[model samples]
Target chain A: MALPGIASFLVTIGTLACIWGLLALGLNVHYGYTGLLNFGHVAFFAAGAYASAVLTMPPPEQVSQANYVIGLDLPMPLGFPVSLAVAALAGGLLALLIGSTSVRLGSHYLAIATFALAGIFEDVLVNETWLTNGTFGMNSVPKPMRETLGAGGWQVAYLAFSALCLLGVYLLLDRLIDAPFGRLLRGVRESEDAARMLGKDTNLVKLKSFAIGGAIAGFAGGLYAHFLGSVVTEQFVAGVTFVVWAAILLGGVASSSGAIVGAFLLIAFQQSTRFILTIYGWIQSVLPEPLSGVLPAIFAPLPDHPSFVPSVRFIVIGCLFVLVIRYRPEGLFGDPNEVTVMGEEE
Target chain B: MASALSQFLQAVAFGLVEASVISVGAVGLTLSYGVTRFINFAYGEFLAYGAFLAFFLSGAGAGVVGLPVAAVVAVLLVGALGVAVSRVFFRPISDRGALPLLITSIGVAFILRYLLIAGASAEARQLPVPLMRPVEVAGVGLTPLELGVVAVSVVTMLAIHLLLQRTMLGKTMRATSGNRSLAEVAGIDTDAVIRKTWFISAAAGGLAGILYGVLFAPFRPTFGFGYLIVVFAATLLGGIGRPYGAMLGAVLIGLMISLGSTYLSASYDQAYAFIALVGVLLLRPEGIRGGEF
Candidate 1:
């Protein structure tokens, strides 16, 4: 690969890492710090992405070729900040709505209910074609300052901008977690009854954390839409929720820096799997003939199977998740004390 | 007016078939939840594996007798696998309460599902069961196979009822589910009861999967996972951890899905289930049964 090619590849991965880092941070607010199992975090993310996409695209009347409903046609400069704001507002409102009902359930029941909520949200995205363009999704999402900066320059600039967003969220969360409110969250997590005894309205505290986490997820979603230049319902699958969950789990639950590290590591792992076939070929070339023959026999279907790498990657990710939970529940950077299974306090 | 009535009847027929599958799955889920105190997100994989295992077996062997044998063996093997899975992955962390156990189950679900995808191609496949045309009964058109699914479902539910009520093991199992510590204090080997519960629950799930595969045909690796939401809806609607509630929930969900798809759009089948679930959760969080299993 050429130098610029490698650089661009790194840049692209870095951009995605930042997006996922933001997502992980959002999840960390729920699971890591507040101990809220918001399994449907992707709902807020999708809400923000579509909200931003709708803001940037031309009005339905202006675009003869468009499929979706509710386009505002704002320019990128105006659209960017507005989209993020809209996304955050949308997400927070949604959290308050969902949290009002679901936040009262037992931890596992809440998880299941939220999972269904995400399904319902995705159903709306797919069925409400006029709103989300149905399955086709909205394309040509306006890139901020794309014309001013060349394509390459835009990529670099966007990378910087996304990194800044990640850093800003990180700093914000860092400060937030150290505040008196953060202790209240910990108090709620460790023992809601105890917090209640202290005159804290634990449910209100939970609702607040959920709304803030949801807003962060919404912000990340908007950034993602701009970076991908599109907002497809497919991007907000259950897998995205698990990926963020895995990232937070890997990074050490509740640690902002851990979320970023976990996101980068997972994205790198995913990218590395794209080269599995090539790596396999190299391994085959270097191995002795008999060993190579045996290896092929063992992995006979891999080379021919187009989805082999993705399957392996998911299997590995799943295994890693289980192993971490079983052996290292606190994760790489999480506090050992905080590793207590949720709902134990009850 | 007659055509509308018949159409409604036809939808009912479809609902019954769908209900059979959902009933079995929900029962398994509720049963496991009753004993385990955690929702197994990976429960869908048992259905998937069961259907696929039967498909592969029937495809690989004797023509006439293969399907029945395959179905039996698939259910048994899945039941055995359930025991092994719980013993290996669940028992250690079972003490950690519902959250860790639930998360682990999701991980297991992903691993099993993708392994199935990797091992079996994404291309849809069907079991080698003999095809029969639809037969009419009481102004409703249903194939003999669909009728068999309902029969099997009823029989299975009856058997479970008998086992829970009439047998010593059933009594012990119920006792354990009600209070494991109390049961252990009473000299009941709760571990054995739990293992038995896992077997029966997974076996029910496996049987449901096979029936679903037979009726739906052209099933894919993602079939069970996709259907999981509906199963969850049914389970929740019936009331979690209540087998009887699950059965009732299945009937309602099945009718809702069939009628909704008929009158509205087929694409929103799962959405309808979600609506029903949310409505139930909001109105009556205890579900229709509103009590312990």
Candidate 2:
């Protein structure tokens, strides 16, 4: 319940919002524009984190753990940019591997395949310790210019850098979505048969969007790794995928601005909820029920149990997902037509 | 070579046990999907509920009378839960389509999982059955409990087959699942059929959960949820919406998973089924069972 000061606060929530905003935008490109459901978008996010971490991390021999492989010991200058490029590449290639076969199956089947692929990806990361270090995860990542900027200053600088990157991505996506390519994506989404009839390489177009979205996800992942200073296999749970999906649905699936708004809104919702929980926790601690213990016991099984808070958190988000789907399929910022993701329901 | 062959055979034997669990679930999922036309991801939650119901029943000292009494009550209870979910969350919002329905299922899954965490300790629980001495067959050690699990699953499958094929309600279910509009025009209540389908499917899933609890030993709320990918693959592998396809596909997938772990690294056993599913979809997007296309 110790409140992080202003600088730490912005970096904590702000950097995360930016990271997730990038992911939401990546998902928006496919689910939003193309109507392709890339259900396992988290795979690319993991890919970016691993790629960046491996490039910058020292070889296993250099450290006590030879548990994972492929560290290059590159300087921040070389490591950071290369990591981005690798993230983009890994994302695209993975998308290609998953997309080429499953995209043909259409949205429903593709959703299942991508979800499974992400699960399989997690298993690989968890079990194949030689590669992903088997769940212990990679740690002690050197933040860019940490020596010069100092710890707190580096965090602030990273937050600024993240904001700038997000802005660049937003502008870039806006232009892309407004262009002819974007229109083509829309066509592919609404009615692939019609697009195919029109002589568009419909499959090819879908594949491109899938790969591009994945690359963006990778880019986001790379940024996340640098900011986080560690990469854990647990980071890519399917819940994270749903959160991004919620973001796009909440913000506005169709627009870049909407994706940004949705990401911020989702994070704010999460943070505010946590703050409320913290306040309740303080209240419970301060006031004894009948004697004070009664209230805490009534409210939470063991007030201090870590799972208690997360359980409440999950309940809130689960309810939110249901309500959002029910009331605002188009989201707060989206155009009415942008409600196409769940449009078929009605 | 001899060791490898025996290991393979041993895997097949174990796979049968795994397949029995998956088949019951697959049948339920396919039957529900047939009319509902949405992937009921929360179907896995039914398994957890069923397992926990029995777990609690035994905890309440239903030990000797457990299998018949406690399990039946659990199945019926979960069936009712399915009906309630169908009426409450799904029916009102289902007008949307597959994506919303799918998302809703995920929401329901979260709710069930968190609820389980809140209600039951997150730690694993035993089914309260005593360990039996292992029975050896062809150099493979099998337990009496394992055989009983398979026997129970077979009886359930046969019962379902009779319901689907012989009984009037079963015939009605078939007609509705095949073509809802046609069935409705013929004065069959598609709504009633859907309700029944949801009930039967959920009950079947609960039974599968109990077997999984007994056979797998020491399970938690997330037990069935973890196997969802394999179950989905099984359902789709046999083709979606086909009445019998789920059972057949589940058997194949169960074999693949068990044998894969035996032969390949156990770490990627789950991936094998997923890979098989992708392969099947690529070759036959309509599923292994041809329908509607």
Cα lDDT listed for each candidate: 0.86, 0.82
How far residue B187's Cα lies from its native spot in candidate 1, in Å, is 2.0
Per prediction, fnat is: 0.50, 0.56
TM-score of chain B of each: 0.96, 0.94
Name the top DockQ candidate. 2
Tens digits of per-residue lDDT for model 1, A1-346: 2238778888999999998999899899999888888889999899888888888877777765577778887887766899888877877788888888788776766787788898889998998989888878888688888888878888999999999999999999999999999988888988888999999999999999999999899888889988888888889998889988999988988788988899999999998788778888899899986687877788765545666568878888888788888888878888777776355322
lDDT of 2 by residue, A1-346 (tens): 2235765776789989998999999999989899887879999888888878888778888766559877777788557877778877887788887788788776788888898888888887788787777688888565788877877877778889889989998889889888999889988877888889999999899999999999989889888888888889988888888889878877877878888898998887777666666687688788855667776567654545446556666766676667777777777788777676334644
lDDT of 2 by residue, B1-293 (tens): 87777788889988888888888888888888988989887888889888888888765344646655888899999898888888877887766887888877877788877777766757788787778987987777678888888898889888988998889998888888778889999999889889988999989888889888988778877877777887788889888877577778888998998889987878788899989888887888777777641
Model 2 pairs in collision: A288-A291, A288-A292, A289-A292, A344-B96, A345-B95, A345-B96, A345-B97, A346-B96
RMSD of each: 2.5, 2.6
Give TM-scores of chain A for all candidates: 0.93, 0.91
DockQ of 2: 0.63
